[model samples]
Target chain A: MGISVLRVENLIKRYESGFALDIPHLEFQSGRIYGLVGPNGAGKTTLLNLLNLLEEPTEGEMFFEERRFTDLDPLDIRRKMTMVMENPFLFHTTVFKNITAGLKCRSVDKKMWPAMSKEALRTVGLKGFENRYAPALSRGETQRVAIARALVLKPEVLFLDEPFTNIRQRDIDLFEKLTKTINQEYQTTIIFTTHDLPQAHRLSDEVISLVDGRIIEGSIENLFEGTVEEIDGTQSVKISPKISVSVITEKRGKVNISIAPREIILSHGAIISSARNSFKGIIRKIQMEGQTVIVNISVDEEVEFTALITETSFKNMGLPIDSEIYLTFKSTSVTIF
Target chain B: MDYILEGLGNALKMIVSLDSEMAEIVFVSVKISTISIILATLAGVPLGFYVAIRDFWGKRAAITILNTLMALPTVVIGLLIYSFISRRGPLGVLGLLYTPWAMIIGQTILAFPIVAALSLSATQGIDKRVEKTALTLGANNLQTALFILMEGKFALFSAIIAGFGRVFAEVGVSMMLGGNIRGFTRNITTAIAFETGKGEFALGIALGMILLTVAFSINILFHYFQKKRM
Candidate 1:
């Protein structure tokens, strides 16, 4: 709905350890919140580093505001965007100095530093913390200072790499609110990476799912890597020791499969169904994402599956936590890659 | 035993009275070591930092060479410099031998490898995120490098102190290069060596006490910085 602020074409990054990130195309619009969802080693952080210009792609062209990245000075471009790492490393000095680090680098007048830093701190709900030493702050407070440091620069884009990892729930709620405020007030284009599916859907206007360095359609929930096998004239993937899902795949050997959360039907009891795959599971957790209710069910206490349903269906079904349930899906719904 | 006790007593007396000769010796030793360490730090810190952050062919080999130099014997450096600055040597036209300048040059060589090697380790020990954080915050390449140096300041301070300690206690380079010129180039270590050989036990013991105190203080400061870094 907005103008494109960043676009990547045919991007690729290769590491010495044989890990490679390949993106055919991607675009980020201004004034929009985008969430990158992936598991560990899924290249979420690598992509963020490339988009933030903290790294050079092994092969690709990046465009910012229709201007080619190679045509612009990296420092100048970086000043327009900033990133807060998951484990933010604060400078070994006063919080004030850390918050004003960017401004100092820009050669801003010394007189305006105090007021600017104070204002930025206030935005993160950390007023009156200027004199405190950076290394002495608590984990949550250190993250807040790091956010304030990035905010003080008034960057056009903000990248948060797993900002909520190892954070308390209360702090997570606060950070979510802070992210929204920064987007709404400053119209900053924000890109954040997380492995939490429900959180990603709740926070971003668009969610990009990544698996093993490649982007894929649909939510990343219920993704499993297993071996394909033909057992008794049926083709299924053995996801776990106690769980197997029927799939319409001719390929064999190790493979990855994903099931769309919405395609699964939940039932209170095992019933006759036309679906090819059905598993009895227990409700592990329930979450609300807008009008959709996300139910997490564990099968045989070994494999967990996430199913999405409308709030009305969820309320009518009256499913309780820890209750036994049956989840059924069509063989065609299980996507193998 | 009586002679040793007498020497100890007279040494304490000379120290308490601030004997002029003892003071001159201490001053010269401090001045020469301080200058050499300063010069070494100026040259070594940046060299070490540059090597630590950059990837190049033979980088490991370069670091190995610097580590090897840290253990170089003082007399070897003295002999090496002696060849260059001695009469009829390549640098003999400047007449630098047997002067305080020659001693400073030799001590600087003795301290260079220690400072550079330790500084390399110090810079390498810094968290990798520090550089990324600074660059993401809009710092230029030079600023980012300086920011990392600032972050590793404690370890670097310990490195420079270690260099000072090595040069301050060395007698071979000072004796060979400085020729132990009294009131000019003679220092605590050379004075202690010469006076003890001449059987002037009081002065020798007094200077030895001073040298130990200085070395002890340097170690305390070094440990303090090392603790601060952690």
Candidate 2:
């Protein structure tokens, strides 16, 4: 969207065993919330570490604002960024001291520390916790204090590695607003990793899943094989016996296309749309994951597609396993990869 | 049994009266052991932190060597220092033998390995995210090291307290190095040993009681801080 603030070219990190992380080319735009989603051991933490400058890439180059990361001063780059790890470890001091740790390191005026710390605390719902010892805090409170600690620095880029693991949604909503402020007010770029698929879709404009060191390119992929048909003025893919979906590709013959489950719109019945891809089906199964519902639809006896939706939407729809529904998606949302 | 009862009664009376000679012995012991532990802390804390964060070859062996040194006997260290600082020994012109400074140096060596070794263990036991979080929060190498040291402060202090316990109760180093001179180099442990040998069980039992109390107090304080940390 804007000029790239951070970019990695041919990044590869090798641990003692396993493929840690491998990214051919990646760019992070300024002031954008990007979510990295993957399962455990999917190199999400490795990429987050590389982006946070916590570890050196075993191979390849990283650039910040078009300058090579190795060429720039590491301290300077790190001073402009911060990371919040899963199960945040707070210092064995008062909450106020923990929050202002980075500021003290930068030699910020001691007088300004209290105000900054209070503001960060207020932003993270920790207004009355200044005098509390860090180790005495609950897990959720410790996490909020950690976020407050990072926010006190007003870092340019924030990296979070599984920060919301086992976190409650109430705090998550407040955290969402706080992150929005960081992006809107300070123009901070944020990169966070999560195994929660719906969270990635809800929080980020762009989401990438790294599975075994390969980026999944989109969220909740539902791959479909279809025969390309060119008619009047557009091309369409016939995916199943009853589903003929309009697509924007020029390729002909048998081909494959992948569409993100989040990109699909579900309705109780057929809905009118101009983009031209829709299928009437029955709900095959309902699977509830963290904060999300996966609705499996059987368009035909031989073909089924997964649809990603929020729990609220699924509840509001009052849909059951055998409920009839219609699925619609834009041709543009279909990715060939 | 009557003599033991008399010794106990006389020792309590001496303690309650705040006897000056007994006070000097305790004071000398505290001063020397405190200085020794302080010196060990200054050197060993940084060494422990450095060893914890680095990944150089032979790190495991080096840590093993430090842990082995934690078991070093007080007399072994005293014998080594005595051989070097004795009148016929090399560089004996300084007259450090038979002085409190020699006692401090010997105790410091005895405590240094324990402090460093326990510090290493404490640091290794911390959650691994601590250092990474510090680095990501803009801490430079030294600052990051300090951050971790602060995080592990409770355990680190416990290590120091344990070292102090050792120095406070040890007799071999103080007796060998300080020559047990009255009013100048005599400490609680050496005075207790000397009085016991002279059939003066009253002072001996009294000083031994103080040593046990001090060691128990140190352990209590360490456990207090450790529990608070947890």
DockQ of each: 0.90, 0.58
Q: Which candidate is the best by TM-score?
A: 1
Kindly report which residue stretches of model 2 are placed more than 4 angstroms away from their true locations once superposed: A218-259, A262-305, A308-319, A322-337
Candidate of highest lDDT = 1
Task: Report how far residue A334 has shifted in candidate 2, in Å.
Answer: 10
Residue B89 accuracy (lDDT) in model 2:
85
Model 1 clash pairs are: none
For residues B124-156, could you state the per-residue lDDT of candidate 1 as single tens digits? 999999999998999999899989999999999
DockQ of 1: 0.90
Q: What interface-residue Cα RMSD does candidate 2 give after superposition?
A: 0.9
lDDT of 1 at A298: 94
Model 1 residue runs over 4 Å out of place are: A228-235, A249-254, A288-292, A310-318
